[model samples]
Target chain A: MSQAIDLDLLPEPTTNVAEYSVSEISGALKRTVEETFGHVRVRGEISGYRGPHSSGHAYFALKDDKARIDAVVWRTSFAKLAFRPEEGLEVVATGRLTTFPGSSKYQIVIEDLKPAGAGALMALLNERRVRLEAEGLFAAERKKPLPFLPQVIGIVTSPTGAVIRDICHRIADRFPLRLLVWPVRVQGDTCPAEVAAAIKGFNALEPGGAIPRPDLIIVARGGGSLEDLWGFNDEAVVRAAAGSLIPLISAVGHETDWTLIDHAADRRAPTPTGAAEMAVPVRAELHAALASLHARHGQSVTRRIDAERRHVTSLARALPSVDMLLALPRRRVDEAETGLGRALRLSLSENRRRFGEAASPLSPNALDGLVRDKRADLRHAEGVLGHALSRGLAAKRQRFDRASLSLQPRAMSARSDAHRQRLVDLGRRLPRAQRFGLERLRTGLDAQWRVALSLNPDNVLSRGYAILRRPGAGPDGQPITSASELPMGAEFVVQLADGLRGAVSTGTENAGAARTKRARRAAAHEATTPAKQGLLFE
Target chain B: MSDLNEPVLPPDDSDVKRMSFEEALAELERIVSQLERGDVPLDRSIRIYERGEKLKSHCDRLLTAAEDKVEKIKLNRAGKPTGTEPLDSA
Candidate 1:
């Protein structure tokens, strides 16, 4: 606060000054910086870092414990940076110290910047990781599960690097997946942004767009120093990895080197090949599993069908036999036969009764009348014959008397006796022939009576075959050979060997029912008629 | 630039690209399982099995179709993709 001691040591100002314009002063200052500090190297921690401006210039500040100075890098020089400048990164920047008159600030126009040392870069990385972790960028919950099978895998790495080759080779060895490489500078000023942009670009893809969306992503790079691998530790790259909708795997540097992206990624692999292995399963293993599943499914279905078949077979075995199901119909058939026999016998008997009634009027009385007529004719014929004979004898006697004078009397008498004998022989033979013809007519009448008796239904019934007759006046009433011909609840009669029995037709003669009925009838018949036992089972 | 040394490139066929290896494998597995279950009708089973065989061969073909093609993504000054080139000399 004291202003007393240094007055004599201060220099005096001259009155004849040049009065230069702001541009002139700024120009002189720019030339002085370009010449004096051209290609100077400065080591300091990066601070207030900013990207290359649209005009191809970067604005930033370089700071030490005592002071901080504004710095910049032209786009051309920035392109040459081996590592990206970040806040709190101790780096050695080589470029001229220049001044921006507009802001009235002095700065180093950086031609190149590199991390001061591996330890410094690690410190910077740890600090960045701490800040990112606080923002939940590396939270376990933010990580996504890798797809079991990724249709495509997007890789963000240098195309010429061994990292990409390792990844591709490993993936080919395992299960080949469609690969899309986003060529990027793995370790340079542009590395972080390029990596981040690649991640975002893959995410921006539509699922079925011209450029297929990657199901998984791998950010990979080969082994390098902490500074060389620092791009993966960058905030932008970490955020991109954390924000990716597609699952990501970080494989940077050797197995011992850990990057911030590793924490942010869904999975972290020790090397690029390892990341490839994590991306897809073994092809043969999956194929084998599918085959086994197929086999198991087949076995399961076959067992089910087989068990069902066995159940059906058991059920079939428990069912009733076909013959047992036909017994009732067979019994109905027997009953119908019996009824027909009885009905026929009744018809025949009725016919016979009607015949007797009609024949009674034409009996022996009529025959006696015929006999009287025939006797009268015979008597008349005998009278006529006697008259004719007497006339003829008188004529013959007259003729004989006339002829007697010319003949022998003894000869004439002999001839008249011979004629009387011939007449007697003829009368005897005619009566005998009529008697023989009468005996023959009686024998024929007896034979016809025997035939009529034998043809009677009663005779057939006595032979053990019954006739069944339905009481109606239609074709159905004639006789039923099949149970289907009988209507439900129809009345019928069965003529047995000795008598007739009335019965009703029960119309339940389906195939199975008829079979059971027939079987029962056969069994019963076998019991009653041993001679038919052999035919029952047949 | 390395692609200049490469031989003739294969003709562009979008069908192969449209069918993903993963999808083909999944379909093959599904078909095999369906056939194994045997719940499918005989005709249907045969049809699906035929489809499964096709899918299996598709997967195999996909794996063996080409060698790993490592390509460099060509970019403009602004880092937008322009095209691609083979990463190797051949």
Candidate 2:
């Protein structure tokens, strides 16, 4: 019966490759998950911890004091992580077990982690902070000043959130600084990797020459729980911040809030507002500075002007005019003028003397000739009368003697008188000689004297006619001898017969010829009119 | 009270620019201090007092001008500028 059963049984232990529909496979997986990974508390040290990446998925391990377990965290669960898990950290993970069929790997899918021992995890973090702070890692000296004018500020936070909006509004209100948003998780398990990546990306862009490098970076977010700001506290973020070439301002939370990033950054502002203030200078303050400088400059200029004015006033005092100072030079000039006038008078006298001496011979004979000619004519008349008289004289010698005596006295009296007597004698002898002849001769002489006197320029001059005697003469009253005589001007005398009444220059006369001609004319006038009594007899 | 109504002369550029803001203020204060001390020669003391008065006025004018500008800027944000006009001018 055993042989027959073995022959018939099992139908060759059917190796049908375990038939399964897609639905059945999933059902089995669900069943396995429900059965094996039912709510359990697993003790382990976390290792190869990947808290959160882009998809908000966390992958890590839960390790015991000796061993670790693989685990995964959905973004929803990771969003609530109180503390960050790291490799080699002992923890008790509470979660439902799950299996991944693709890799046939079992993971804890941890919902929660707590310190394996009794002490709180936060205490360890605080101690770590204290240790870092003790090393001067959080010192104020470790910080750098924010840029005055940030051209491009790198913002690292979630794209769709009030934090970014608040930061943006604050920055915009304060100053129109350029913003470069790099959306990354500010909290949750994925944040550390994303935050580190954002920092590195900005750094790499500079090395790659993708664009002009940002002047400064603003690692900013609104206020949050410590865990919410955990990514900034991450070791990766801290190292990246320390290593980055760009200066960074950590604007993590409200004024009261502080984070690990605050310590690691080049500068840590208490709030986003404080960060903005640190970044930009106030416009009002700058304007005030410029105004003050202008005022100071104006004041300095005024002082210099005042000093110059004082100098000018002092100089004015030094240069004042005084009567005593003016007296000496004025006296000297007056004395010189007196000397010049004396010299002019002396020179004029000498010129007159020289002119009179040179022109004496050219006289017109109106004075001496009248006397001498009349005397000679008288003598001839007397001689002829005497001859006639001698013949008759014998008879009346006495009478003749008496006549001679009377005549002798009369002969010396005047030739004109004697001529008139002879004429009377002739008239007696001829008895036909008329008084007309004698009268005519006398009238002729008187007429000649009148003509000569009229022709004398001095006659009219004596009657108050001013003779404008230019220094020279042509036939006209002008001083020019010829056209060529118009050379340097000559001095002229307008003589009034009395004295030199006026003087001028014929700017057109040759000075030498003009002077000589003037002297000759003046001399000719003097020669024609001898002085009345004395020179006429002499 | 007499000082309040008294006229003041402006400082020259050289005097103003020689000192920092704080130093200038301190010097102005020193001038006031000297005036308060009143231990100088009459002529010298008068000059010092005059200078102090001028400095006080200058400082006051400077602060007043600054305040005026600040007020104007704030007012400009709302509308137009208005205030007590400067003396002896349109």
Candidate 3:
């Protein structure tokens, strides 16, 4: 109240003095506020944190228990912040205090901002982790299997630290690989950006580029506190590791230390050395395995060859001998020849013996004996006829004398003369009859002699028919009618019209014998070529 | 499957060197199994065995020839590698 009364008592300014507009005064205020507090660091809980304006400026408010002040962070500075500013989160904002003339308001233009403490940072980290995890960035299925043997290994770490040395040494002990170190700050404000950039840079390398692309990546750092290791847990680094095309192994801090990178990477090693060990296998064990395989190969091949050889030997033993099969037909030929010879001899002798029996009854001596018996019969008949005639005449004379005495003497003498004449005629006729009988007998004898001459053996032989006989036979020996009756191993004679032929009986000469021999030869040939016979039979 | 009458050719070294350690090892194991099957011809078996030996030796050489090389990547103001320097292990 006193200040207001005093202002009222003081003299008003003269009209000659220059007057100022509201815009001018507001502009002057803005300049004074900006110049007075050029740069200030404010600690407050974020509230009403809103917009990135169209001019790339963020409008927000920083408040505490006593008061609240409006703030702005330019997009350029906001883009550089490692973490986002959210409502209800305490943060330390570093920037200039400036006044906006349009609203007649004063605000801090933030240049840099960070979480106020480790707890605040952790809260931000957990928020980010939850968001990213919800996005499936940390899904187990998203992980890739690390190559059993990587040709080139890209590393994201501080080149000046012992982490790289341990990794290199451990890899050398196991299996060596080409290491492409991408040096970066492992902690601090710049650490996340540098590490993320390194990972992205490795991923962008062309496979056939001048610098060989890495088959796998290892992001590693030595042990540190939560603040020191916060970079690995940063969203930029975790997203970069998760999005990498190559398989990644995260080896940050000690064995128990955990980072968001460990969750996002394809594999997590307890330490830097552990990552190296996982990359390759031991060399000596591989050599031993190869040797064992070589021995097994040799043994299997030898066993297979031996089995085949044994099979061939057994097959050879199952075949038959050649000589035994040939003798079956030879014996059959000899029996056939002997049968044929016996049949021929029986036919020839049967013909000769029949001829001899037929000729004996028709011999010329038989005809002569028949003629002599006829002549003797004729002489005895003549004597008996003469005696009967004389007796008849004497009885007739006595009867005639008695009858003549009673008859005339002239008739009696005439009868006697006639009787004497009749007797003479009878004697002449008897002689003629005997001559005719002898003529008939002589004609019959001549016909029998002609038949006997026609049936002679010598005459039959002269007509080109030959008789085959065994020669030099004794008187008791009849003509051989069968081969069985003929002597064995004897030479036989064949009589023809010209001369006699001597022939030895060759028992093996016959068609049957020849055929049997041919069959035997064929059987022998077949036995010798068992393979051919097997094909034929099959 | 290998043909019994196919001509056997010697193993080529440049070809073997181009293979990765895993590829080489896998090929070596394949050769051994093929030999164990005993269906391959003698000449082919011998040739494959020789190739297996070369692969084994190549793997051995890879392990023996390796030396740990530590290097520091040097970056410019824009964080691009300008060159490299030997890294101190200590």
Highest TM-score scorer: 1
lDDT of 3 by residue, A1-538 (tens): 3444667878987789767799998988888888889988999999987646688667889999999999888878866765556678899999999887998878888888877988986787788889999999999999999987777888999877589889988887776657889888787556888999999988887788765678999999999776678889878899999999999999999998888999999999999999998876765666676567657656766676676678888997786556655566777877888799889999999999999998889979999999999999999999999999999999999998997776888978999999999999999899889999999999999888888877665567765566667676522224556655434466777767676677665453354468778989988997887553212111
Give the range of the ten consecutive residues with the poorest summed lDDT in model 2 chain A: A474-483
lDDT string for model 2 (A1-538, tens) is 3444565655666576887877678669877786976998888767786546789787877655566567887877776776567666667778888766665566777777666663544555577678777767666665666655454566666666676666666655554545656656677666877777767766655432433345677677788765566567776787777666787888888888877777788988887767767765544564464455445544544454566679899998888488778889999999999899889999999999999998987677866887899999999999999999898868798787888876675567787787888998886866445666788899999878877766776666665566544554522355333445333554555666656633444555456568879989998998899765432211
Ranking by DockQ: 3, 1, 2
The sequence of per-residue lDDT tens digits that candidate 3 reaches over residues B1-90 is 677654454346568888777777787777777777777866666677677778878767665665455565566889876655666632
Docking class of 2: incorrect
Arrange candidates by TM-score, descending: 1, 3, 2
Best by lDDT: 3
lDDT of 3 at A87: 70
Instruction: Supply every candidate's count of residue pairs whose N, Cα or C atoms clash at under 3 angstroms.
Output: 35, 16, 0
Q: How many clashing residue pairs, candidate 3?
A: 0
Cα RMSDs, all models: 43.1, 40.2, 47.2
- Candidate 3 local lDDT, residue A384: 100
Worst 10 residues of 3 chain A by lDDT: A529-538
- On the 0 to 100 scale, the lDDT of residue A489 in model 1 is 82
Question: Model 2 Cα displacement at A42 (Å)?
Answer: 4.4
Per-candidate interface DockQ score: 0.11, 0.06, 0.25
Candidate 1 vs 2: which has more DockQ: 1
Per-residue lDDT for A105 in model 3?
78
